[model samples]
Every structure is written in structure tokens, then in C-alpha cells.
Target: MKNMDVMLLSTSCIQSQLMKELLSESLGPSITLVNQHTFAYHDWNKPALILVDLANLPTSNQPWELYLRGFKDNISTVLLNTQDSISAQKLLQWPNVYGYFSHYEDQETLIRGLTKVLKGEHWIPRSMLIEMLLYLQSIKPITTTSIELTSREIDVLNLLSNGKSNTEIANELFVSEHTIKSHLYKAFKKINVKNRVQAKRWARCHLPLYDG
Candidate 1:
């Protein structure tokens, strides 16, 4: 049987090893586990998939951000988290963020999420998905602007309106926390808002049904 070449990144050496064992035991020797710090410097093109544990690492480093930006077209990213709201918002904006799984999710769910991501599908927990949809509904346009945002950017805006932090948003969207911040930085500039609080207030005021 051919093994799927997977690169697992985690700050916890033990957890990384455990995940490596799990993947090897379940899917066979085709999977390879590399330490997160080392994996960041390696060429990402060789992996069938890359699994990132956002909750376990720092998000502000330039190297990590560069790695993510560079790999968007070269490989798939599967972000695992404990549902950090702000993180979810930032990560969802990146086109490469394909899958998200909560730490609380069962093993079957984790496998299913990874499988879906590998198949080029975007996967988010059901509850978070619904919340995102509802947020979009709440922020429906009252007026169209000259400014434009991608569908994913708009999704990030809606989550911001719901008071989620970048970390939370990243987890929700299955993206790296750094990716989420990048989106917010661009979104804020485009929307003419200075910070998350201002952005949310502006969105609420401009959105069709927002009473505030």
C-alpha cells in the first residue's frame, strides 16, 4: 500500500511523536513527522499535506508567516486548535487554510477532517460553520461600497463583528493565527478601521439590519 506523505508540525515533542505514531499505525509508513521548528525551514512542496498545531506555537514570527505564504500554492494546510476565536478569523482569510479540527473532537472526527482537507475541501466544525453563516446574515449589506473583499475576507469581517479574537477566528477557520492577523490588517486598511473594535462597529453600522 502506498502511504500518504504527511508532515506534522507541533510544539509539543511528545504530542508530535504521538500523532506520528497514530498516523503511522493507522495509515502506515508513508507518513513522516517533522518537528515544527525544523519543518518551517524545509521545502513544503514534498508533502501531501501539512498539519499545523496553532495552539502550540507563537504566531508573530516572520519566518512562520513567510513559510505559510510560500506554501499556499505548494501544499495544503490543516490547522488544529482548541477553537481560538481570534485565530480562526485571521487564518480563514488565507486561501491555503483548508481544514480545521477542534482539540475536543473525537479521533474519528479528526481523521474525517484531515481526509476532507486532503481532498481539497474546506472543513470546519458544524457549530462554527453555522455561527459563520449567521454572522454573514447579520452583516448583510445595506450599501455596496467601492471597496471590495473576497468572499473569505467578508467571512472574517463577520466573525470580527461577533467579537471573536484573531486566535479564536483562526481556530474556527482552520488557519494559522498569523494568517488571521494578516487578513485583519488588510481588512482594516480597506475598511478604514484602525482596530478590531472599530472594524466591528463600522460593520455593524453599515450592515443592513444592524440597529447600532
Candidate 2:
């Protein structure tokens, strides 16, 4: 985060100002303040870090809509005062999110988390990380002794489990994306999984012995 600007976007004047002071103390001249409404008019480059105060934003247009409205995927993002809400855990997994500030954390902790994110490290609560791991670990193995899979189907599942997009899998397997999708749809039906994320969990939990 050295020699880079950090942008703060929020609707609340008080919240934005308070955060500005806190961040300025640690970040010094690298912090720039911008209101939510004036962002489109600003002629600034994409910042090194985009810190968002989600609490002050309006929620009428779907919950995470405000947060994602002007976010840049190239920049690291940190949510302000996320606390322990059930939905916060889900938000943590979104792309470009480097960390979050829990409502329960002290101001000093917020600075530390920001510094960690600036240094290219993700800062997340240990409990949430463990919970996510346990959830993935708990994907019940599908009873599939009666089912059969083609070699291509196994290739699709293996690649999908490794986080390859359908297009990437298709490119790797020398097939069209449509063919990959067809394979995935059939694989989903056979394994009783609904989506790629679920399929990945199932593969991780059950596919160790699979030589695919």
C-alpha cells in the first residue's frame, strides 16, 4: 500500500469522516475521501485499496448492490464494521475482498487488519475460516456405487473441483463449452449436486480415491 492511494466510499458523512481520521493516522497522505454520490464525477485512477462502510449504505436495491456498485476488481477491498452477521461470512468470499473489520474489533485492530490487507495478505476471522472449512468438509458423499461415469465426465469434475471455469475446462479438454456444460449437467444429475461449488465440495470430500 506504500505510495498508493486508498479510497473510502460511504454515504454517511459522520462514518466516512471518522474512518478518514482513523485511516489517516496510519495511512497518512495516501488516503482520499469520496462520498458515494460524487464517485462517478471524480477523475481519479483506481485506488490501491477500496475501503467500504457497508453499514451506512442503502439496502433497498438488494443487500450487496451498494457495495458492488463502483467497486474495482483490480483493487483490494475491505468491508468496514462487518461484525458477526450471518451474511457477512458469505460476503467474505467475494472476489477482491482482502479483509473486513468486525464491529466487535477495536480501532487498533482495524488498523492492523488494513495494514495486513495492504501487504497482500487476507485478514479474516479464524472462526469464519474454520466454519467454511468444516462446511466444505461436511458435504455428504453421494452414494454412487450404482452409478457410472465416463472418462470425460471424470475429467470435467476434476477440473471443476480445481476451480476451472467451464470454458477453461473445455479449452483444456479440447471440447466446446457447450459440451462441457452438457457433461456438467449430466454429472450434476448423477451425483445429486446442484452447482459447481457444491460439486467441488463433493469432489474434495469424496474424490481422493478417484484416480480421475
Top of the candidates by lDDT: 2
Candidate 2 residue-wise lDDT at 3: 52
Error of 2 at 182 (Å): 24
Steric clash count of candidate 1: 23
Cα lDDT tens digits, model 2, 1-212, are 66556778677587678778778888555577776666445544545576777677654223233334324354567788664764442553344677777667787788887878777788877876787667556644434685566656766786787677988776656569999899999988887898888988877776532323
Those runs of model 2 whose alpha carbons end farther than 4 Å from true positions after fitting are 41-47, 60-72, 133-212
Model 2 clashing residue pairs (backbone): none
Candidate 1 per-residue lDDT over residues 1-212, each given as its tens digit: 12336777666577767876886676444566665456655754454576777667666423454345433355666777646553433454344566677667788888766666656677866676676666656555644576676555665676678777888777656579898888888888877889878989877776432223
